[model samples]
Each structure stands twice: as C-alpha cells, then as structure tokens.
Target: MSGRETGATAYLLREPAAGDVEGFAELHVRVWREAYRGLMADEVVDALSVETFRPIWSSIARAHAEGAVVDDGRAMLVAVLGEEPVGFVMVGPARDEDAPAPRQVWSLNVAPEHQGSGVAQRLLDEAFGDGPGYLWVAQRNSRAIRFYERNGFALDGTQAQDRHDGVTELRMVRPD
Candidate 1:
C-alpha cells in the first residue's frame, strides 16, 4: 500500500490508461509467446503480435473514462503493476445456450513475467465478486487448470472450441 512497496515490489491493479496500450500489447505478445508457444500454432500466436493489438489500452481507458466499476454490474478487470499495465480479465453473461444463467469469465490473461505472482488470483477475486462464475481454458493448458483449481473452480463437464486456435477446451466454474 505504501509508495515504496507499490512502485518497487507489490503490483498495483487498477484501471488501465490509453497510454498503456502499446506497452500492454507488447507484454501480451511476449507473454502469449511464452505461455502458448508449444500449445498453439506459432503462426497463429504470432499474428496477435501486430500493432493493432495495442487497443488494450484504449479499451481499458474507455471503460475507465466511462466510470465502469465492479459494482456497476459489469465484469471487466485490468491489472496494472505500478506504472505498467500487465494483465486483464473480462467477464460477461454466459453465451453458451446450455448455460444456466448469465455471468461468466470471458477472458483472462496475465503477462508471463507476472504470472505466479498472485496477479491472476487478484483479478479473479475482483471479477467473481462474491458470486459464482464460469470460464473456459484450453484443455491442454495444464498450468492454467491448476491455477483455477487452486482458486476453487472445478471442471464443469462442458467443452468448447477455442475460436482463435480451434483447440478443444473445457468449461470450469466456481460457485459461491
């Protein structure tokens, strides 16, 4: 909470700024390469490294400038580390026709350098906010599966195709 700890050590999760776009997109490109290199096709992941991906900052800035809040009944959380934007999680109503209700994690990504540092957990804590929610992860992403399991999410016996890579994924959920 102090300036010293925050700036040098502890990560500070906050609304991202439009200025953060380029940096975040850079981090995203790097981290995705680290986390998905072998699990996904190299060409597909490489495509995401383009400059247009910099919209990350603009997207977060728009939501922040609009005064979007957790209690505002929407589900989008962007995590920042000190002066740098590092990760983001977006949640929205479940889109699957068989889902019982609305409210699910649409996406979650953390910079590879920041993973295992409790950043994703903090993001999930904010996104779930005292309720049940669901998310999907590539079935082959054993690391992420363990991370979600540690946070109390369980396999929901559902599966889907990942639109970006055409990989099979499992739907997982945590009920409050």
Candidate 2:
C-alpha cells in the first residue's frame, strides 16, 4: 500500500480480522498507556490490562471471520504495517442519550512512534470518514484534541467524567 499523506512505511487499512483480536488488545493498552499516562492517574492508566480488553475486541472481530453481513454502519478499521497493527479507529452509533450526532468515534489511536506519520489520519478516514459526527476526547490530551480539530471537530461545551477512571472528557462535534 502507498502512503496516503504521510508515513514513510506503507500500511494497509482494513477491517480487523479474527486473528487481530490479540493485537488489538495489546496495541490498545499500549497506546492508551502512552496517551493517558500523565493525563490520568498512574494507577488508573497502568491498570488497563490487555487481558481485560481482549474479550471486547474478540467480539467485535468475530463476525468478520465468520463472513457475516455488517448491516449496521459501525466500523472498526485497523492500520496494519506488515504483520502488526500500528493504528485503529472504532466508530458506531452515538451512545449518549442527548448525543449531538447519530454517529460517534468511539476510539482512535496510533502508536506513539506512528503518531505524526499519518497512520491516525488514515485510520480516521477509513473508519469514521468525513461526516457529521462526534467524539469524546480527554480534556488534557492536547495532541489528540488538535488532531480532532484539524479533522473538523469543534468543542461542544459538553463534558463528562469517565465512569472507570473519572477523567473529564470534552465532547467535540462535527456538524452537518
């Protein structure tokens, strides 16, 4: 695969395979730790075990391996560099009762090493696309907030505290 806009190494952007469940768990934990370390409590960030996330990813990727139809608009795209997943994005229907949009970017992350290499942008495009949606990002994650803003998101003045860790998250919306 050719580079979309950045990144020297080529990567393939596609839906996750069943075999990718473990990789997703591992990368998700690693990226979460890197991105949330200083923003959240050390114990909270370090407590995100890969074992806990594996079952969740397994369920998400199960249908892909079973050849099931993906009728729901939900999508989870993975950016794979060779045999490893370097980035990923998960988008689906908004979860909030008073959501700004029907679609939401549930999660998006790129390995710290691939942050500015455009892997995150590519994953965002493949999974969420250019649309009127929303996402909740950590208030202290300046880098991620900037990236989301560059991708057309604007702070909507709404905020929430994570139930698990109690970190405040700001809601950003992309309007139609």
Candidate 3:
C-alpha cells in the first residue's frame, strides 16, 4: 500500500531489496539519533553510525535474496517515498518469553519529516494486520506510547531495563 499526502508524493511499502541496504542503514541511523537523542545519553546517541548497521542490513538483504527466512522470524518492510526510504517496520514472533502475544513489533521508525504523516500507522497496518502483538518501548517515549495506544495497544504493566543502556522499557500489547 502507498500513502499520498498533499505536497509529498505517495510512498510505497514493499519488501526491501538488497539495493536498499545503504539507504535503509542511513535512515536507521538518522532516525535512531533523532528519536533517541533526548531519551538516551548524548554519548550513546553520538555513537550511532551507519557503518555499524550497514553490515547487519546487508546480511538481512542477503538472507532475503537467498530465500532464507530471517533467524528472528521477522519480516522487514520499508516505506519508500520516490527514491528515498522513509520508514521501516520489523515484525515477527515474540522475542520475550513472557510476552502476552505470539508476535512482536521488533522495530518501527519513520524519518522526522514523515513522523506525523501516517507513515508509521500504514506500516503497522501492513506489518501487523488485525492480529495480536506486543512491543517494548522506551518508558519515556510518550509520543510512541500514545501512537501505540491509539493503534489498539495498551500498557501491560511489564517493564525491563534495556541491556545496553539500562533505560527502562514498558511492554504494550494488543488483545487477540
């Protein structure tokens, strides 16, 4: 599916191809910095780089091309606006042992410019359908928590510390 706003050209959501690795990696780093800057330490945010993630994306693209299922059992979908990759979502089997749902939203990110343009919702709809799922979100990221709530997820009272930075994350789940 694609989204058509007033000024911006419509964006298409599709399975990412190997050629998208570079763009995806770049977008990932940019969005991570923009999204986590205030929530995480400056040093942690500054440490993010495209180079660190490019190899991982390359591996994903390779596995996708070779018809090998992602070891994490997730599907990676990218939103392309013209030639630029604007957003992406990763969804699959729950990684947490105690998750209430069978699936989880491993990640969802949109460029700052496209944040309020419905790109995230479109990606969520495409990736999650009407089924139940769950995701861990930074407890302090109110925008994302509200977005998930508006999309039918509710706080499940489960919390954990992120292993890397020790930031708190809360679990949100959608009923089956």
lDDT of 1: 0.73
How would you encode candidate 1's per-residue C-alpha lDDT over 23-105 as one tens digit per residue? Answer: 77777687777777777787887777637566655666676777764463466666776677777877777778877445788
Off by over 4 Å in 3: 1-8, 70-73
lDDT of 3 by residue, 1-176 (tens): 55555245577888878998999999999998998888888988899899988998898788778889666557888899888999999899998777799999999999999989888888898887878999999989999999999999999999999989767899999998
Superposing all C-alpha atoms, what RMSD in Å does each candidate have to the true structure? 3.2, 1.9, 2.1
Q: List the residue pairs that clash in candidate 2.
A: none
Candidate 1 lDDT for residue 106: 77
Q: Give the deviation of candidate 3 from the true structure as CA RMSD.
A: 2.1
The local distance difference test score of each candidate is 0.73, 0.87, 0.88
